[model samples]
Target chain A: MSVSVAQTALLDKEPQFRHAIPTRDGRTARNRARYTFTVLAFLLPSAIPLLLFVLGPMVAAAWVSLHKWNLLAPMQWVGLGNYAKLLTDPITGDVFVHTIYYIAGYLPLVYFGGLALALALNTALKGRSILRGIYFLPVVTSWIVVALVWRWLLSPTSGIVNTVLAAVGIHGPGWWTDPHWAMPAIIVASSWKDLGFVMVILLAGLQAIPTELYDASKVDGAGWWRRLFSVTLPLLSPSTFFVIVISLINGFQVFDQVYAMTGGGPNGASEVVVQQIYDLTFRYGRAGEASALSWMLFAVVLAVTVIQVRGQRRWVTYG
Target chain B: MAEALLTARTPARRTVGRAPRSREAKLRLAGVIVLHLVIIVGAIAMFFPFLWTIITSITPGASLTTTPALIPKNPSLGAYQRLFVERPFGQVILNSFLLAVITTAVQLVTSSTAAYAFSRLPFRGQNVVFGVYLATMMIPLQVLIVPLFVELKAFGLLDTYLGALLPTFATAFGIFLLRQAINQVPRELDEAATIDGAGHFRIFTGIILPNIRPAIATLVVFAFMGSWNSFLWPLVVLRSPELQTLPIALAGLQGQYTSQWDVIMAGSVVSVLPMLALYVFAQKYVIQGVASSGIK
Candidate 1:
């Protein structure tokens, strides 16, 4: 009986083992096919819209940049003509300079102010959440709302800011209307709206820092300022880098607030690249010029992003 | 934990080293006080504008002389009434809501499916595809507006809701965020389900989706807010008044009623309410979304 049982077990095991290899291989091939299909199926939904709207438009914009075609007119081929015009155009140059000036004035306040807020809120103090919420309110609010409210607030005649300044024996400039103050006004409103975002990001970076580091620094006899400069800032570099890059990108694309508040007014003091693009395309009936300007803006943004990516290694430290 | 440690060490050090310890404690207390004071001032400055907006909106005949009041002397809902009666403001609100909701829903579907593929599925050139997706985030919508407009026109979708909605239907940021969320989910659960003969779809729907609810919630708030607040594209598309979203309609109102600050403020207040309510309710998810995603 034992010998018969052993013989049957051996007979069963031999055929089963021999059949298992090819079936396993077949299963793997089938699984691979299944995975490939699933991946494609999952990707197509996003890929279709993204390709149609984003990637395809990028190429199309490039094509449009090379040709002149108003909505009603026949297409005219103008290879590099628009690009040459963008370089020579005084408006484009002024817009580019203004964009830079705005960035220069805006980014520092956002970064430092944001870091200060984050540092304050990072403490285990009461009502920190409320403070955070207050700071963050403007971030969720629409840019148009912010612009409108600010426009009302900064009105030269009746606005609260000038009124308060008058009470304090200080004269406030005509913010949105004055060429000197228009960009500054936009910058102030933008800083206010964007402050919360930077603060929240920095707060997250701050919280991610382990308690052990602070304790260790304390034990090492580092004062608050020293500890902050050495440990906190170094560790928070990545978030700072992120904020700088994002702010620069958004700064380059400043449109909504400029549109709502100034309409690039006071002789185009606050005219940005996007506002210029809008005028060229719709108002002036120069789609080709607009497309070229758009490409230029894209190139500037891309260059800045690349520079930031490369420059981050100098300052950004990871633990 | 650090706070406790600092307090604990202070008490211990105080017993042995009284003079310096006391000075340090006093300094620390002063620092805390100063910190709180600065934060309070900043908070007030941050909140004062909104407060002013609210006061201005409610105050009847809110003009130059009666401006900057903390409390409205004679508050009225006349401007709000004027907003709806004078213009198709209610319809604009509906349009904004419909667009935001539809955009959010579609973005959820597209982003989640693509995120699942990027995070879980192994396929050829996955890295390259994902890199391309991420690259899209750097390309601002302003760059594509002209061509996108042309493309929509080509498809005869110009001045339509579909045109406004199509460009926003898929976002690289959403996909990146959701993919990061999915990556946090444990792979063992997926493996276990697969061992039970479950397919990728089942695992994605059952395990992955369930685990990433917070991320989804975060994305919802973001996408909703984005769509609700979107100005440029909606401004460019949707030429007709009937199809106009709230922001565009508000811009129109501003143009039409340039000096009617009361009505304009009222429009601003009304447009901000829904989003403010959303933020108040989903504050946690929104903050966490921004924090975890590490995007502004």
Candidate 2:
């Protein structure tokens, strides 16, 4: 798990107080039983649902991935058959590539844009709080609403973006309607929505950097650019790494925006992995194959996350 | 002030340092202005789509092809009326509201109890069980939706609100967040209560819950927003129009009325306003929560 610095700090703190129970006489055994029962009672509310819904479903997914079954049909044992089929399926590869394309475009744009916002707002500027609120509005808005608004904003003929571009004597690309542009359109909305989230995280990181470091650098004749490079970014690397890992994980599951905007249409140029899983099960009645592909995605996500966690030690400076 | 004092002390270097210091102040002022300009521009770009949505929703007879006027000549509330009168939007919104409230309430109870267990109660293999819960956080709901759907059907919960709400009753993120909050409460308070013959239940309610109110508020806002905005499970489970939540309803509206920008944007406004309102009121908690957790 690529735990963020903030989360790890919380988790690593030692328990502050421990119960001191006397081990005299036969009361100790009764007290232990009573303590166990009380603990179980406290945990029961969440434990039942977690077991039935989350953990059980995970095990079931793996089991179903090994069998062939539809919603209304008897299960046919097909051990590893779905995996083999999906491995050869070209759509699976295409969806993975398209998902990668989304991450490739989205990660850099959102990260840098958010970094700029964080840096700008980290100053003691007036109305910075209001500005933060404005930037974060889209983050709270649902993806469906965002996609619809962007679909209108990026409408090929009379949308605001194209209208503005045409005023500048540049013809705008057919954004959601064009095959080559669909993913980019989705990427734009996705990045716009997430910039504030990244900004919030990075801004916290920037605020955590000690002012003494900047003062020390200033005394050393470090200019603005030098201070930014030498002082700000290296210290901001943990939050940066946290943001990237999260964005990459989320980018692979990009579905709602694509589902609303293009429906993976215009020659299926924008079909991503999660949407593929959705379509395979819901639209095509291929539950087993969908489960297989989901497992593949799980593997990819796990591998990527683990690699990032391991790789963070190389670049992520703690302080 | 320090620079001024230093330059004043050395007469020979006074003129040399004073000139650059003035220029440096001017440069700093210019930098601040530039920074504000860039940030303002970015803020406008971020807010423009929302502004456009509101504008298009009000402009009568608006369609996607019509270039939206920043200030409508004669705005009308007919689109909102159409949303309620022509569509079952009233019922849909109510459904979403009810679901969000119920989900938030249930999650708060479940998560707080579980957090109380993890933080205060020592048990065998406690770390291992907690680790398992944390590990589940990394698994996306997409991986479980298929089996979850099948399980719901077996339980005869498909196409019901329970189906949509069941899997969400317990969240690892909520438990983790609340656990952190509970750990911050002074243990002496718990010990004092225990010494006074207070049991775990009373201590949880009287001491822990009251102290962790901020975390509860944060979780409430997030849980409400999450349930309100959740799409995949609701879409898969709730098939009836009468039971549609906001996101599912809006998606259906988009699919059904592909070109009706006014009605669709009106729906967008209705859906977004509650969240923005909640955010406006609790912006600090929301931002701090996201900053700490990096999840939303």
Candidate 3:
């Protein structure tokens, strides 16, 4: 009986195969050539710009990293000199350390804050959409605007934050000015701006989860916390992993806010790698060192991303 | 079926235990109230900075006083009027808008064509090419700024609007996004079009483009926002005050008028308004785009 059934299946598929083969075979060499040409034509426009702006610059940047050349001066080769400076220079080491501190403070706040917001909005609550829009407002606003406004609000003496603190009979720390509080202030502001983005991504993750799992967990006598841990978190790990990688990459390139708000200020207390690169190239006219710094940053980002990609296998679950 | 089971179990459970049900309902009500209260506080915190900026911008003689007023006692548009008159605020806005618009348009064209080839047209080493393209996304614009600037100088395109615009024209993110969208278009449609003697361009322009309008819109929003908020590259390239974009100008204004809180606040408001309007209108596309790209 099984042999007869297999025979019937093959017999049924034979005619369809006969019908499909001729059509595919009918295309001549000229037609194939034309099709190939069409693909090339379609690809060329994007490829040129990508090569010139992105690909070419990448190679050129690598070349520049090995040489000492100001805009006016002729190039002088300095193999590994800039990279050596990255190790020996105290400011570079300090900036790299500050960046790690920033990531330490920033990553958790953004992930947790974003996840908390997403959970709050995920319920069948009234006006949830409006609340979402309110949270998302800062994400769309320009960094310059965000940084400037935050600077005003965190002003050491007369800012609203300090005013509120004084009203509670507590002295507010000098936020952007004080060395101790500067990184924290920046971390808070940066997290606030980015919270909406992470929240939205996680919300998407949350919404994609089927309701049956929650119902099943509830039927199994699981309470809210148990259900969240067992069902939601396991399922949401993919998005969480995404948020971690993106936030980490962005954390390394933390320039705009620092540039606009702190200028790596108060004796380089809030300095980050990108800001250092900016200063090295423009302020100090050390183009080669700056390029090397940029490459170092790129390598760090690449390494982190590779680690995340490899690490996700241990935690992230996809259904 | 599961929902039906839940409903059945809920009703039966409630009927068997009235007192417990009432207590549960009460607890749920209280929990909801607390949740809403927390969300409201968060909302206020999120909106407060913009509110303070607007208030400061409107308040005459707004300054760094011990007590910052939440509401302006005497609001005026004087700061706004002075902003445009005292600085090239209008010119800056124009430059930003022009660059953003041009960049968005060019990226859409380049990204769509490339995305189409990647998604529909199978060729040699397609995966390698795409992998290279995606890898470019990992390289932040900051890494390329120095060399890109030098290259532009070599081409004698430095300080031109074209210089500010060129680096933005082709984005790996845009291509990746558009390719994702194009992949969703069924291959059957392309085959059908090919059977009718329609070429690759015809199908891309007619069928695929129409089907992927949402992706196009998403790319448009991303590209526009990127150019609008772009600071580091534009700062490095455009040295002249006349060629300065909005964010660059705002930073410059803050530097020149460090003590003029009102004027700086006004500049912040002006710089933020266009983006605010865009977000308000295109919130769905923006969120959807971020969500889709973010996850995969």
Candidate 4:
């Protein structure tokens, strides 16, 4: 009876009729067979590499996570111990807090600073394209290169930043050495590297707004300040949403900059979760602990994704 | 006569409003100029380090610390010479170059095909399969590092080129993006090919590939950059310094600290120059790819 009701409900929407297999002529059947072979051949080239590297590794990781083992050691039957140990680590907890601080610092510099810069560029002017390219130059360059550049800039006594500050009658702290300043300096550098991308995304959002909306506002005696509040802010929210989502994701995965600039140094003040995990695994040779930490990071990112995906439905407009 | 004087006075007063209007326009112009100046200056603020790296790299080592000139007062190739002469720099560059090329080629071929299959083909459980594929994009490598390392060991592929290349063979974003790219290829073309005697493979290779060169080019540049600059996996798997990629070796330059600035900067310049050149040449494709990804 339940099956009948389910079938009736499905059919009420529109029953999907299954078509019989076509009895094609020799030529058509040959063509179909050829098409099948073509797709299979095309797919094989792409699928094989992924199957070996990504899919296989994923399953293997889960299996390994269940057992306690390290390199040069036999597997111990510690089913949930690896998982439990990650939750209890004091250092991992500290890293998690700093990671949140990093995000807090990262958001304002990029989201707000990027939007403001993008808006400034969207103005009608000569040499705008040239300016855009200069801003975006870092986006294309690898973070490894950017990190190297900032390492020099953030070098405290000999660095240009401090030198310039000294010229202005202000003393600058040793940025890379000062634990309090390390993460912030790293944030400043990451923000610089990231501005080009944020600028572009925001530029796209700005361009998409209809000129008519602005014109209408102007006709109704709205000034630049008034029009921005009424029209631009609402329209720009979707782009803002996209930026925040990815920015949050990036905040979670910020390793290269921290790894390159500070190496989680000045006594682990700049240490992010990923770098902490790297240290445990590669530095300390604690594979299980690192893996456990990784799972913790993964869980955090997962929760954030769930919230953003759900939140997007309410605020993100397709256009 | 009295009314006419009053009208003239009113018209004269209206001209005062016009005077302030011109003044307001001047003020607006001044404000815009100041804003642009600030933005431009800020943009330059971030690039000072890069500028210094390039300048210092050209400077002779003796003057590097003694004089630290912006224009590299006595510019020389001495550091570049040391980078190559004192180390396996050439081999490392070749390793990075070859690894980047092969990885990109493998990724493009594999990703485009899987994308096409997932996009164009009507297979059994297609959505489910593709969902599984998309899910992999978020599985951070750190989580799987231990298992992958163990697996590579079992396969006896540690420190091998294949081991370096294996993990990135399939990128979820590549497939997703390429599928977005290939979906724009009209289904009518495939149907027409079917109408002809051409097999599926012939149609795909001959018809599809020729059309989607831009997307493929975009993928090639992106893949090249990703593999060339990779750090963690290379650091972990490759125990031999000779087998290390440029990034790994360059990162190792960090241990030398203050003494290694010029050499490290030289290495940084070496690691990035090829990519910068490639980007300059194929910038049209790269920019379009970057811009389109914004909308996505």
Residue B108, model 2, lDDT: 95
Per-residue error for B233 in candidate 2, Å, reads 2.6
Candidate 3 local lDDT, residue A65? 86
lDDT of 1 by residue, A62-173 (tens): 8888988785787799999999988987888999898888899999988888887777666655676678778887887767667867887899988879999999999999
Superposed by TM-score, candidate 4 places the C-alpha of residue A53 at a distance from the truth, in angstroms, of 1.3
Report how far off residue A11 is in candidate 2 (Å). Answer: 17
Which of candidates 1 and 2 is the stronger one according to TM-score?
Answer: 1
lDDT of each: 0.75, 0.77, 0.76, 0.68
Interface RMSD of 2: 8.7
Which lDDT tens digits does candidate 4 get at residues A21-114?
A: 2244555877667656766776777567667777787776666666665655876667778778777778778898888999998888888888
Pairs of residues clashing in candidate 1? none
Strongest candidate by DockQ:
1
Models 1 onward score TM values of 0.76, 0.75, 0.76, 0.71
**Candidate 2 residue-wise lDDT at A127:** 76
Mark the regions of model 1 whose C-alpha exceeds 4 Å error after superposition: A1-42, A148-180, A202-242, A310-319, B1-29, B64-68, B84-91, B112-143, B153-161, B176-218, B235-243, B255-258, B285-296
TM-score ranking, best first: 1, 3, 2, 4
Span of ten consecutive residues with least summed lDDT in model 4 chain A: A13-22
Quote the positional error of residue A51 for candidate 1 in Å: 0.6
- DockQ-based CAPRI category assigned to the predicted complex of candidate 4: incorrect
lDDT of 2 by residue, A1-319 (tens): 2224323333333455345333446767778788788888989899999999998987888788898877568778899999999999899899999999999999999999998778776655677668877887898776766776798889998788999999999999999899999999999999999898788667656644545566666567766676677668876775677578667777878888898789998899999999988877778877788888887887887678777756766766542
